[model samples]
Target chain A: MKGRKINPKRFEIGQLKIILLILPLVIFMGMPIIFIINHAFKPMEELFAFPPTFFVKNATLENFSKLIKFSDSSGIPLSRYLFNSLVVTVITVGLALLLTTMSAFALAKIKFKGRNALTHINQIAIMFVSTAVLIPRYLVICKLGLIDNLLAHILPLVAMPVALFLVKQFVEQVPDSLLEAAYMDGATDLDIYLKVIMPMIRPAVATAAILVFQQVWTNMETSSYFFSDDSMKTLTFYMNTLVNVNNTVAGQGMAAAASLIMFLPNLILFIILQNKVMNTMANSGIK
Target chain B: MAETTKMSRKDKKALKERMKHLKSGKLERRYARMGYIFMIPWFIGAAVFLAYPLGSSFWYALNNIRITPLGRIFSFVGQGNFTQILIQDPDFMIYLVDYLTSTIISTPIIVVFALIIAMMLNMKIKGKGFFRLIFFLPVIIVSGPILGMLTAEGAGSISAIDTQSLTSAISSVLPDIIAKPISDVFNNMITTLWYSGVQILIFLSGLQKIDKSMYEAAKIDGGSAWECFWKITLPNLKSMILLNTIYTIVFISNNSENPIIVLIEESMFSGTKEKGYGYASAMAWLYSVVVLILVGLFALLLATRKDQYEKQVKRAIKARKKEARNKKKIERRNRRNAKKIERQRAAGKITTHTTDRSDY
Candidate 1:
């Protein structure tokens, strides 16, 4: 794959064309994120300027300080919401990954009755629009007396079928002969799964984790539906409240700041795990 | 390598046989038991979470149910909710049409954009990782009220362009149908780009899987880049395209801005609709069917060739005919054996009474 550089026939467009194509696209894509950061720092005048400026004219810490005060007024410290969100997201991602890997290994490597049924269920679940399941899921949460608890958010989504779907596809690419060889070497199925299959599909695991984390982190619907407690509220919920409720002094800027704060974890995860994610084994077994 | 070679082919065959046999007896049950053990968590999760909810929703869609302070009330009205959604609510039908049309138009656009970007990024280049990060960052950052605030009016419209004038100009010159969708495209350009983030990643991963030699061979054969792309790249991207299409459809259909979804939401719990739960459930179910149909249509349109269809038909026919032939052969063999046994019994040549069943 790396051999083509010697010939230098990369078949790329001219430099100007490449620049033209990439530059505007990169700008358009980055503008919202850039604007979010700019909005965070912009003064009140700049933040509310007509049509919105592309950059902050007079950068200030006033909005951030105001945001700190806003959290103070709410009585539940900002750290409480932040801590709850952090704990929920971390546990959700870990549990989701562990459970998904187990089910995926069973579906992909082990043969037993009901496996076909499970596979079909996952396929159907992928097509499932979330809205259809929303009311019932909420009702189920209510019935289980799990409302306002963090588990309500974590439990419903941790066994998501998409993670299972992707992992199963990747695991199928694992050679049956390799499995047999491991068996002949006196490895139990669990040992082979953990030591062999897991390492082999790290890229897939990372991909699933990234996706699962993104879903849990950015989810705006769940906390609202399930938790009404101020104490149980997440950073996202707090931000939602800040954006909608506060049309007062330095409101927009603080919302932007809160958005940035909320976005930081995703940004960090993506930046750190970017390479592993792009090497996803989702398409490895495609015909 | 020499040690492996020293294990003769016969020994290898024997080993395989033993392994095959080893799967039975105590080991088979052990693996099956372990499989079920591993499956326990998922089974519990599915039963409690997925299956129950999905089944209950389907049930709710069929009946009029209300929530009161005391307890829930259920009054079964078979297909009444569906009928009301389909017949009485002509307004819903319009939104449904609008939703389906927009999804049909936008799904292809997003998938194609993702593919083009994927193809471009697949070329080895400097700062490729940086570019990938830039493209995907929006997907992470842009969501919830922040995303809403950005796309909302006045303070932070995503684009600074005079969209009103641009859309008006486009509408003035072109027919309304063409103008509306075109302007919609221009208006949603930024939003669409945001939506395409994960899709680009998915497509790039898929593009990475194609053998570099395929492109090299095509180039060696004097194929232009365009030709090589259409032949090699697009065909290989077929599955990923299907995946992205499904993802985009499901994603957009559930967007908060979707009128149908918004309407359903209002009816369900918030509003004073008489049969809120049932009607909303009905609307959701109908909407899901539409989304599914659109996905199916994309899958059909993007399917590679009719040749595979014909091959499937031929295989089915051959299997049916072969089964009949095998059945006929078995019947003839059974009849012949029965006749020989009867003749032997009639001739009294068998001293022992076999009872016509050859246990020996």
Candidate 2:
């Protein structure tokens, strides 16, 4: 039987057919990414070349140096925005992970009053576009006196409905018998949650972490809306201003460089945690 | 043996019920308390961030609000803001129509593209991870400003495709209203495809979860690949398709690049007295309702339709059950008539006689 069996993973001549079909589409899909990198490296002449070049003939770091020079001339240095973004993203990701996992555990495993209702609310929350909540969210932030406060950035983004939904679905997959076994050993709920549940849902936690990080990292809304002070502004907001302030032929290079800088962290994080993200997606389909 | 097994099963159920009773009040209460303790942060967060804002936003939509250095001033305007947005606002209606048409056209394209890519990736191929990495790259890098910059530099569409000719051809064949969005889709084709990054992964994961033996069985039965896909794969993927569709719609609606969102943001900051917090809230409400309706429409379209085979089987079963019921009814009526005739004959009100062919 073993001798006659076909190996599923072995490469076959037939596989070439699929590769041929997919290769062109993959290249087509990958063009923008390639363009982004190339555009960032293009020298001034190539950047503005008529019949825009897809690939850079002359690669240069002039844009990066010029961007640094421009930011240095401004009142707040580039480091300030970078520092603010890093701090906010780290804090928000940490808090959101804790909130989401805890709430998910309660909603999924615990048979309690209002659990169903809370779950339903989270589901409904997923349907709401952020724009729908923008006005009231601003008003709430104002009433809470979070204007210009770093907490404003952290608060509105912490309770992510989609993250909760994903995490809850994951937590539900933790077997009841395992939890009961822990309970029989006189383990407290916190002990079970921290020891038993957390270990099982590591992929979900990682996924949620990446999600919150990306959101807080790229978010300019919080800075543009809440922060009046230039020093407190995030890198994304700063980048936006950097490009818009110099919206000209010369500014195009700086804009390209800034986009690359902004896009790099998300790309790196995803590359590192891509496996866990795939795992989370496997469980993400609406049942 | 069956009797013994049945008795044991009953006994087991009784024992389970007794255990449940024994563990009822105190233990259940303790778990409930623990659950609430676990949910405390979310409760606070939801109240401050979700419920409170939702309530206040609805209230804000109904009134005219001005933000002054001193404080916020509010005047009751009832449905005036909604009416103004619906009737009086020129840009709102135009942008809304454009948004609706574009979303309706682009969503199916994105989902189908994602599905095709997902299917290809699922096959036994070399460099699967590399392809997946490239495919999923967009989800991470895509942001409002970055997308804006990319599109500005004409990186949003393929350099090879002659969008000008394509758009002209589309416009020549189609009406102005319909052609505009189709042309826009072609012009920004790459960005539209980029929107399907997460969707591709979603489909890939779902496809993986399907039992491979089902495909094997179909193959053994001499089914073609196309037949297997339509009969087996498509039916199994119904829920995932709906999920991806809804996700695509919501993502498109809320995207910062979306004109309606940008319009709302502008109106909220506008210095004009007629526009501010109240007007933006009204617009947000209206936009959200439209998004909800779109989601509902897609959900109804994908979810409510039963599979053709399943529907036929259900109808067959119903017909069979109706035939059985009719047979039972006719037997009962014949039995009642026979009993009536026998009673009458015994009581001397009638006599039973052998019938000829004419009587039949």
Candidate 3:
């Protein structure tokens, strides 16, 4: 070992390098996020101003007020869309997470014949072309008299390939000893899944939940197809109606405001559960 | 406890009977059977919701799908729709070109930027978690129709800004007159909107597995930070980069809500469905093929890079040892020269004149 001491400046330089590195992230990610907030608060006229206002000198609740007071063709309230999105997304994510976790736990942990076959099946399912299934899915929904119902969206998304893949990756991390101990306690598979496995994989569950919710929330294909009435439209269909059909500045502004508003639920969820989701993905690489 | 014990005995009897019915090694088989049971709901859903329609679409693509007052029906045209796309369509070529160009440029940028951000995040820094969360916020925010709304509203202003910045950077070394028009059109057409969401998440997770000690070792051996990045970080990220690139190309090419697709949908809504579905399907299939090829190429590149990397590493190790040996030899020569001077002084053979000669 050479008789050389570490330079204090090197540590400072490292810190400086970090700050420099983060500067771009802050500029790119942080600025747009701030713009969304600023745009939300600004009055209509200011938003349309030639040189965009980064900050609102005069803020108003007019956009939110207009959104609430307005009604679409079906006379269903805007709250209905919000309520519908929440209900559909919650159900989809919930059932998907539950079924995926159970299957993943069983596949990853239990020594069983045909596990490899099932895993291969899951892999093949990942490459499924949804467009090919779109017409049939619609027909099935129609035949079942579930067309225009929220279950049409919820049920289809519940068998998500990505969620299953993610949960399988996560469940791989669970120590065999833990599952063995639970088995030794004479816990049934159902009891083990609900009580033991569920708690241990909370972070992975959160990631899967976030991802599922985001997918269901943004899903325009199945959800749009179901909503024959404008009133029954999800937020995505509602926003699209403003641009393609309505074609008015006021409508577009309202759509923009509405889109911004719809983002809040997911954004807030992400912010709150972000640490858990990221930590899970970082440590487990599944999320 | 005694009363429950009697009930438990009854339950155990039932369990034993059920196990016997399942049979010998069939218990383990039953566990897998149970696993498949869990998978059953999704499997059925996938069949009903995914497989059936996809199979039908293949049939539909080869036929004429008409939504008449009677109902929806498909008239089999054999290879008619495919021929129309390949030979009869006017704008088909332009559509393919546009799709391919965007795929080639946008997918790589998104993947590469995600990689860089991931690497930077991997570095031990304060507020690292906060940075990651913020970066991933775009995933939640950039919904399909919301993105449409943003696109319609801004008319690609963000893209324009990025394009202009890039063009100017390129133009700084170019001739002025030649640069202006080229720059303007690029500023108008080519924009670098941050391709958001899952791509970012994939990159972030990919960064996590790289060990930190590699960087520490490089630093100890007098590698500059940039050199360490080139030697250590970039090579380790190959698999993630490949994975992300594949994800991006596939996602972008297959993206239904892209601007051009939206335009096509708008036209169809305007009551001109003549050959629309067939056309869209053709474009989609082509896009899929291009993406598959691109991903395949990237995978090949990644596989080959490993062997190349090992060779480079071996060469570097040899070079480092050679440098160390050279330094040791120089040190020994300096020690021998010092001894020679000391001997000259001991023999009194070196006077002030002799000392001046040594200095010379």
**Candidate 2 structure quality by residue, lDDT tens digits, B112-135:** 999999888877787777787788
Using all chains and alpha carbons, the TM-scores for the candidates as numbered come to 0.79, 0.79, 0.70
Which residues of candidate 3, in runs, are more than 4 Å off?
Answer: A1-14, A51-54, A72-74, A103-133, A166-204, A229-246, A280-287, B1-28, B122-124, B144-193, B206-242, B263-286, B300-360
* Candidate 2 global Cα RMSD: 7.0
Off by over 4 Å in 2: A1-12, A73-77, A101-111, A129-132, A142-149, A166-209, A248-250, A278-287, B1-38, B140-142, B146-180, B211-224, B227-232, B305-360
| Candidate rank order under DockQ | 2, 1, 3
CAPRI tier of model 1: acceptable
* Candidate 3 C-alpha lDDT tens digits along B1-360: 675466777787887779887755856767767777766776677667655665565666676676668986566787776677667767766666665665665666677677777667656566666676677775555534444434455533444257757777868978875565455445423123345456566555444434456778889999998897687767765655665665566556445655445544443333445564544444444444554566667667666666576899999999999999999999999999999988998898876453556767
Pairs with steric clashes in candidate 3: A132-B53, A132-B54, A133-B53, A133-B54
Candidate 2 chain A TM is 0.87
* lDDT score at residue B137, model 2, on the 0-100 scale: 78
User: DockQ of all candidates, in order?
Assistant: 0.35, 0.40, 0.21
Summarize candidate 2's per-residue lDDT along A1-287 as a digit string, tens digits.
Answer: 11111124677898999999989878877866787888899999998888777899989999999999998988888898888888889888898999999999999998899989988777667766576577678878888998988899889988988788767756776668888888999999999999888866766676667667877887777888777977888898989887888899889899999988988887787777656534432322123
Ranking by TM-score: 1, 2, 3
Per residue, candidate 1 scores C-alpha lDDT tens digits across A1-287 of: 11222112344655346556777688778877786788788888887788767788888888888899888987899999888889989998998888888888888888787889988776666666566678789888989999998898788888788778777766776678778878999999889879778866776687788889988887767788888887887888888789878867657778877877877788888877767755534323223
- Taking all chains together, the TM-score of candidate 1 against the true structure is 0.79
Clashes of each: 0, 0, 4
TM-score of chain B of each: 0.70, 0.80, 0.60
